[model samples]
Target: MEGLSWSASGRDIVRDVDLEVRPGETLGLIGPNGSGKSSLLRCLAGIRPASAGAVRYDGQDIRGWSARRIARHTAFVEQATEAETDLRLGDVVALGRMPFRGRWRGPDRTDREVVDAALARLGLTGLRNRAWRTLSGGERQRAHIARALAQRPRCILLDEPTNHLDVRHQYELMDLLAGTDRTVLVALHDLSLAARYCDRLVLMHRGSLVASGPPGTVLTPGRLRGVFGIDAETGHDRLGNLTVACRGVARDPA
Candidate 1:
């Protein structure tokens, strides 16, 4: 996205953000709540129209593309999505195949295969027949991810995907994203997880781009204090991963 900006009720939620997510890389968007991370993701995915700026895919402006055409290239998983109907888990995930299906056609054999593979990819094959509403929060998250995977998009945009997941699931999800060959942009609140799993990090603050770089360079002690209002000690962990330990909230000098 180039010079991206979004506004609501005359107030800017996302301001003049220029970002380029590299191909085949996992890029983490980290910021405090309401810092416009989600808004940026929406603009990047072409879900929410940008107030000012252009979102380009493969060197062409995406604004000229149709919605379904955009869907074919980019998959987006929202922060919170729920299936209110009587849809089964598999059916919910099958929604991802809509972009690939023709207007008059239904799920063909290949569509079914893709859906099944997505379920298997997220370890949801065992629960494919379960009611969508009956699943736990983490399960719901996984289902959304599987749906994105089924889309077979070149770029995937996820907003706070780790919500409601346990510690193990969180790590597993990050690992999966990091290992994938597709370009991925994931919004996250956990600093250490982003630092450890993401090839690069983009930190947002107050509707502006605060910092963007590799984990080791962006996730620093002074940045932690200024950006997060916490005093943290940052260092590499035993396995050479970036680790951060927060001491406490920073106290302003008189």
Candidate 2:
């Protein structure tokens, strides 16, 4: 996206921002609460129209593309998605294949295989028959991710996908996303996870792009203090992965 901005009720929620995700890379979007991370993801996924600028996929502007067309290329998983109907877990995942099927077409062999594979990937195969309403918060989040996987999209845009997951699932999901061939743009609050898994990072502050680069470069102590108001240090863990250790809230200089 170039010069992307979104406004609501006469106030800009996402200010001028330019961002690009490299193919087959996991890019982390980090910011303080209400810094417009979610809004930026919506604009990039083309779910919410931008008040200005353009969103392009492979250099082609997606200004007028149909929702289905966008779905075929990218899958978007919001922070919180509720199902009105009490659909089965498998059925919910099957919805991802809708972009590839005609209105009247039912699940074929390929669709079933894809959905089943997605279920197993997210470790939800055992709960495939469970009612959506019966699942716990973490289970629901995994189901949504499974649905996105079933879409077989080239790119994925997820907003705070780990919000409801446990620590183990959080690491597992991040591992899966980082290892996948699909381009990933994920909004996250966990700085350490983002620093460890993401190939690059983009820090958003007050609805604009503040920093964009490798994890180590973009997540410097000064940037963290200035943007997040936290005094933190960056270092490599025993596994050689980058980690952020926050000391505390930033204190005013004496």
Candidate 3:
């Protein structure tokens, strides 16, 4: 996106944001609450019209495409789940294949195969026949992701995907995202997980981008202290991965 901007009720929620994510790379967005992370994702997914600038997908302007066309190229997973239907897990996942199917037609063999594979990929095979409303929070989140993956989109936009997941699932989901060949843009609050999984970080503050680069460069002690208002140490772990530790606020002079 270049010079992207958005507003509502005369207030600019996002301002002149410029960003790029190469194919197969995972870019993590971090910011304080109400910093416009979710708004940015919504704009990128074409759910919210940009007040200015344009969003390009595969070198074409996304504004000209229909929602179904956009779904073929990009999938979005919001922070919450709302299942109004008694749809089974398999049926929910099969919905992702709708983009590729003819209108009023049922899924073919290839579509079923894709749904099955997606279920297995997310460890949802055991719950394939279960109703979506019966699953736990983490399971529901994973199921939503599986539906997105079933579409085989080139890019994905996720908002707080780890919200209800435990520590183990958090790591597992991060690992799963890191291993994918699709380009991923995710909004996250867990700075450490962002450091571990993201190839790059985009830090936003007050509706403006504060920093953008590799985690090692963007998540510096100074940047953390300045943007997040927390004193933190940054270093590399044994595996050469970036690590951060909060050391509390800086002391004031007497």
Candidate 4:
């Protein structure tokens, strides 16, 4: 995206933001809430038209493509969502194949196979026939991700996929995404996870880009204090995983 901007009710939500994700790379977008991370993502997915500038996909403008056409290449997993309680797990995942099927047509053997594979990938195969409401919060989140992967999109855009997961599941999810060959663009609040899992990081503040680069460069103490208002220490752990240890919140200047 070049010179991207978005607004609502006469106020700009995202301003002059520019960013790019390389093929097969995972880029983590990090910012405080209401910093336009979600808005910027929607524009990239073609769900919301940009108020200014242009978003190009594969060297072509994204505006020319229809919603369904865009879905073929990008799958979006919205933040803080709850799966329908009445629906079976498999039924929810099958929705991801919507882009490839005719509306009037029913699921074919291929669609079922894809849905099963996605569920299994997320370790939800045992819950495939279970009711959605019966699953725990982490289970539900994983199921939602399974639905997105079922689309078989080249790029997956996720808005805080780990919001509901436990510590173990959070690590598992990050590792899963890190190992995938697909291009991933995820919004994350956990700086440590971003540093550990993402190949690149984009830091946003008040709807503008603060920094964009590898984690080592982007998560410096200066940027952390300036952008996040936190006194932090960042370095590799004993196992060589990047880690961020925060001292405390920065007090407002007198």
Q: Which candidate achieves the best lDDT against the true structure?
A: 2
Better of 1 and 2 by TM-score: 1
Model 4, span 18-100: residue lDDT tens: 77678788899998888889988888888888877777777677777889998988889899675456888888899899999
Encode model 2's per-residue lDDT on 61-94: one tens digit a residue: 7789999998998899999676667799899999
Whole-model lDDT per candidate? 0.85, 0.87, 0.86, 0.85
* Colliding residue pairs in candidate 3: none
For model 2, the local distance difference test gives 0.87
Let me know the TM-score candidate 2 reaches against the reference structure: 0.93
Task: Name the regions of candidate 1 deviating beyond 4 angstroms.
Answer: 1-11
**lDDT tens digits, residue span 1-254, model 1:** 32222222114888888777678888899988888988888877777777777777876777767889989888999997655879988998999999998989999999999999999999999999999889999998999999999999888899999988999999999988888888889999988899999999999888888899999888888877788888889988789989989898889611
When summed lDDT is taken over every stretch of 10 residues in candidate 2, the lowest stretch is: 1-10
lDDT, residue 184, candidate 2: 90
Give residue 145's error in model 3 in angstroms.
0.8
TM-score attained by model 4:
0.93
Q: What is the C-alpha lDDT profile of model 3 across 92-187, one tens digit per residue?
A: 888889889999888999999999999999999999999878888898889989999999988988999999999999999999998998888999
Which runs in model 4 stand beyond 4 Å of their true positions? Answer: 1-11, 83-85, 252-254
